[model samples]
Target: MWGVRSGSLVRRRQLARTLRELRVHAGLTIEAAAPLLDFSPSKLSRIENAHQGVDVHVVRSMLDPFDVGGDRWSEILELTREASAKGWWRAYGLDDRGYIPLEAEASTIRDFTVTYVPGLLQTTDYIRALFDASFRRRSEATRERDVTVRKIRQERLTSAERPLELLAVIEEAVLHRPVGGPAVMRAQLARLVEAAALDTVTVQVLPTDVGAHAGIDGAFTVLSFEGLGEPDMGYVEHPMGSTHVEKEEDVTQARLVFDHLRTVAYSPAESVSVIERVAAQM
Candidate 1:
């Protein structure tokens, strides 16, 4: 929670953990704590699970009963304020599927994509083309907003203070497929090559020749945070919706898949060579 700011999923999770621990230390069950704070059991549960935000007033109310005072009380209250603040993504009208907040706080991002470039490495033209090809047609404004959000998210890669380390494994077939026509694909591939030059970024390609692999299921991202005492998080997106995996076991499994992919995929240097070759073809 030290580095986590307002509207961060990490902050929410930290707050939730602290609150739950406090309640446990106070010997109060969720049932008992809910009424004391004038919150429904379900509402309290959501807050403790990081699914909902708590106001500073409510945080104080909840902590008072547990004899939490002084700096500890002040810190929790400040976190509450930050937790309830609106995130930058909200301004774009994007739904908080919980990924962005986590991404913002992640120290390392490991992504494996089967069909397209990872959003973080995608060019604006590629994003536009992908959206255009989607079955669910969105308004122009919505599409632009989505692109803007992605552009903002990409800033984490170049952040001077604490840049995020990105390890991306892309399917070889993805390079062959034309996302936004030859021109767009060429530009996107060039972008990939450029990004690969960054010290923080590592791009690898999973050759199509290696048929039937562990990543055949779908694409997933694993976000690792700095010293927050929180476990690694796994994220999966599909046609229906996105899923965030927090359980240690599941995250570890995802990590295993990613590790396997790295072994099977081309090395970073080879991957860049492949990308450059593909761009020439395009």
Candidate 2:
């Protein structure tokens, strides 16, 4: 458990969902509840947005002021307690405060890589080099833990039930990069060729000769979930951190960009040929 558990995030989201339902049932706008709670509208908004955790006392004070029924208050209090419980990821001394919970729930992943292999598909040497290079400033122990977490995350690719559907478009340069030297690069490319054969995995290459592409902006991921429908999310990672974009406008933009990139990328068979050629050169 190196990150927040999926259950905790779902529980927290549920609190907001529940409150919204209650507000709709009561025929009141969020604005009306602000004056009644003696709190700022923004405070209520933050709580409902799942951006802030509500303490037990605070929950009691706020809901009591609203004259919500005793049974309803009890139910909400239980939900709040569930939401506040420490997630399993805490046990591993890793902060899942944001990233883990969201990734754990994604059912389909579409990503474009400009500089390196995507985490889920990376070989051990590539991953080791990636972590070593990434955490150049961290202690050895911290870096090992971080790398181990990434391996655990990759389990989703092989999971029997509800295996993730992954569609990755990687730049040709990624296959040529010798992260851990020539041997590692060859083995990694071989693995990529094999992995591409898997039913759930689709690998495409955007060749350098293609000249221009939509993914020139940088790497991005689109995570889709079952039951959530078409509300795709976009994630952009930087050297220090990653951010999730949930706004419809941003998601739409990411989708359009991905579609364009895919169109320019090599077909699965051609991508395999490119990887095989790279491996043979090594």
Candidate 3:
């Protein structure tokens, strides 16, 4: 797990959760607390939301309003510093890869795809083909960088230490898409079978006959952390943009939907058989 050791993303979220709890425990809301510290409510709210990290001195000032000090105060300040640290993904300068940073830190991923193969299970050829099909052309350097990023992300699945556990349920239509042509699709499907054989990975296929199933809304990934303090996250991407779902209620609903999808999808072994049969046909 990327977060099992150093984790800026998880730490930032953890800090935000703690500060929000502390403010509420002190009987103050963002609007009320901001005035006491001469801060705009939005600024303080952003800090509590982990959108921005405050300097240690600013944190001290913020904590004073809540009458917090001693060890607890020091702990939060340490967390703030940790949260402000750069994540491993930043070294690659992946500004366009919106979800990789979070995905890297996640201990587990529960993905349900209605139209495409999950990134973690895609073959190199399949990856390049998807990029080639993009409406906007990418330079060779940019394309290869993305390919490298995907390969690196896949390492977590087979790591000697604490590999990431993946549970994926995909629509049967995904197998028929022939994303990169017959050869590429065959290799991609074969890769799925290979990955599913791992103890950390489980793949299931939702049959075409399961009409109007639970995941009709589209694809979404629910990422779970080590549960030390960080909450699970729900990520959804669309053509226009992507957003992270952080609310406890919404994330819980995502989990519930995923659970239902798993139930209606083929069993792991049966799913592998389905994938093999499809690849054979290809």
Candidate 4:
């Protein structure tokens, strides 16, 4: 059996892809593989879909029938172990940790926000104020945990190993909205200006004057991975829960919408100017 080790969400996703391909290459369906592995079809399906993790023993069992061995088999076993390991966010006790892992693993992130600032670009004070105003009341401890999580998420932007490339387009109205009052907004705008200066980050503003735009519908983020052989993921957050869109067609549509928003939004230089002007007003 493969040895157990720390698993990352990215590895889980990669393992899912490899397992599905192996099954196809072996000319077996989920129905056939399930009985052979003594797994329920749904359980096997979930593993292939990356909705759950697979043990090293199970991975070896599934691959054994396929006559898959050598480096490919070893690689999959390692991924199996890594996929079972918990991410840092899991310790936070937050209910919905779906998006952070994807964000952490993404090589490129494209975001469009119609309301307040994107979480990745938000300031500490701005995050506090937004949390306070949220309808679902949270304890101070919970709020602090939330803030810590956001701060940790921002580390990827400045990571020495693999800095994240962020392309963020925000609505002009967001700049005008007073989330944390003048001082907070000023600081937040300043942070945006500074972040925009970074080589890995780009900030653009969608002027309110551009009425009836493609992004008028709502906000979303598209996360692209680095050589993971996984499809780009699309995330849509609503009042109830978030939706992760994985279908190629849906992901393509989200990408197109982001692309259109990019074309309509102000240039980065103009955006920094607008941010500075807003900060001066505050």
Candidate 5:
């Protein structure tokens, strides 16, 4: 999961410490705690590691095992409340945990991609084609659910507030490859042409002739906010999971790399011509 937001790592650590202390004070090992909660020992371990959260019910049950009283009960209740207050991503789906809320909250998104086309600009046919590639291993119901969720996620790009400013630097090859075949590629490029006209959107293509560029590291998004206290954050995804980096040093380094990439990439007009050229070839 991307690192915790709103709450600090310190708070998570404190909660873990409190859990451990309660367990020890009650003269129980995690093995002893597991049966009472009807959970595995690993479940308790994961909760303590901050890999999972403890709901109010579980916290109440855990407290029952210990002999704590007075303000302690309410304090633990408050902590659990903070932990369980549906993270911003909850509106879409309980399982999406894709950092979508974090991305939506961001004011600007600078993206660089070289593999499949980025999600925001994907046509339904293109998206279905990409989903089908992965659905070979999934059940039909699961595949349908995945496709539906992706379409909902894509809607954020045009939401009423117009909160996000998206600047994409994509490789020429992405536009050239026909995901759902030639006809689908043509429609996808045409959709791109329309999306590029949005006031908050900018598209640039990194041509093959550019030789080399900084984005070769991998696809990444740099999310910046608009406020006195907000800091820029960088997100990187892998097949296994995603990472969110918000430290000043990391954001600064990614900004420098992206700045260099923007310089080497074709201008927006040139990038549109490149797309037209690829579409014509298809």
Candidate 6:
């Protein structure tokens, strides 16, 4: 459920969060630090809270107050610049609104889905059918646009530099669903089997026989970036909206839930057999 991708992740708060940590470590309060940086209290506050973007020059200046230099200094400044950079999706008129940017930037994704197939693993026909099945209506062009976005995202799975590591756990029901009728679902399931064979992808099935498990709370994802000094992010999507969970406790809990689900789910080989068995029945 890329449900609502237009959440707070557009600026990705790592830069702000890091700055606040540095300021606190420096033993300076917003009031005390504002003058040192030549920023109004509100401006500094906004930057620290991620309400506003800070310039690289301003961020460089901030190092003096915190006595940060060398490697750590370079890291903070790089993070600052990353905060304001535009995503490639922007060129396709998709930007600053949703989980696409974050997904694009993530090096690994732990995806658990209760409804439909995980977007990255969907076949074009399945994607078309899923979009068409939506209760909300849209032009063919918009549906086509979404399909394109999904395809582009899938490219990361085979990228040379850093292929995305995808650990996707889908409820067994996903394989059985007649997403685009029998043919489409069959192809999609076949694709799942093929993808699971890759070194970079792992596909697991949470069988109904598990009865109850940690993932009873619906679907969520845990995304890990390669290295930006940021913690893993937890995302949950529902009908009305979606949420970005960054608090350490919440993300940790999501991780635990996912771990439990993985423990209970079928092994990769068994999962492939399960998909094949299900497809045969259809």
Using lDDT, give the best candidate's number: 1
lDDT of each: 0.88, 0.77, 0.86, 0.86, 0.75, 0.85
User: Which regions of candidate 2 deviate over 4 angstroms?
Assistant: 1-11, 31-43, 54-88
Model 3, TM vs. native? 0.82
TM-score of candidate 2 relative to the true fold: 0.80
Q: List the residue pairs that clash in candidate 3.
A: none
TM per candidate:
0.89, 0.80, 0.82, 0.90, 0.67, 0.87
Tens digit per residue, CA lDDT, model 1, 1-282: 223355777878888999999999999999998889888999989989998877887788898887799899888888788777777777777544568878877889999998899999999999999999998788999899888888888877887776889999999999999998999999999999999999889999999999999888989999998876678999999998799998999999999999999999999999999999988877
Please give the clash total of every predicted structure, in order. Answer: 0, 0, 0, 2, 0, 5
Give per-residue CA lDDT, model 6, range 158-228, as digits (tens). 77765789999999988888998998989999999989998889999999988888888799999998765
Ranking by lDDT: 1, 4, 3, 6, 2, 5
What TM-score would candidate 6 get against the native? 0.87
Query: Listing every candidate in turn, what is its Cα RMSD in Å to the true structure after a full C-alpha superposition?
Result: 2.6, 4.0, 3.3, 3.4, 7.9, 4.0
| List of clashing residue pairs for candidate 2 | none
Q: Per-residue CA lDDT of candidate 5, range 107-137, in tens?
A: 6888888877778788888888887776257
- Tell me the lDDT of model 3 at 240: 79
Count of backbone collisions within predicted model 4: 2
Clashing pairs in 6: 5-97, 5-98, 5-99, 6-97, 6-98
Question: Candidate 3: how many backbone clashes?
Answer: 0
What local lDDT score does residue 266 receive in model 1, on the 0 to 100 scale? Answer: 98
Residue 225: error of model 6 in Å? Answer: 2.8
lDDT of 1: 0.88
Report the C-alpha displacement of residue 252, candidate 1, in angstroms.
1.5
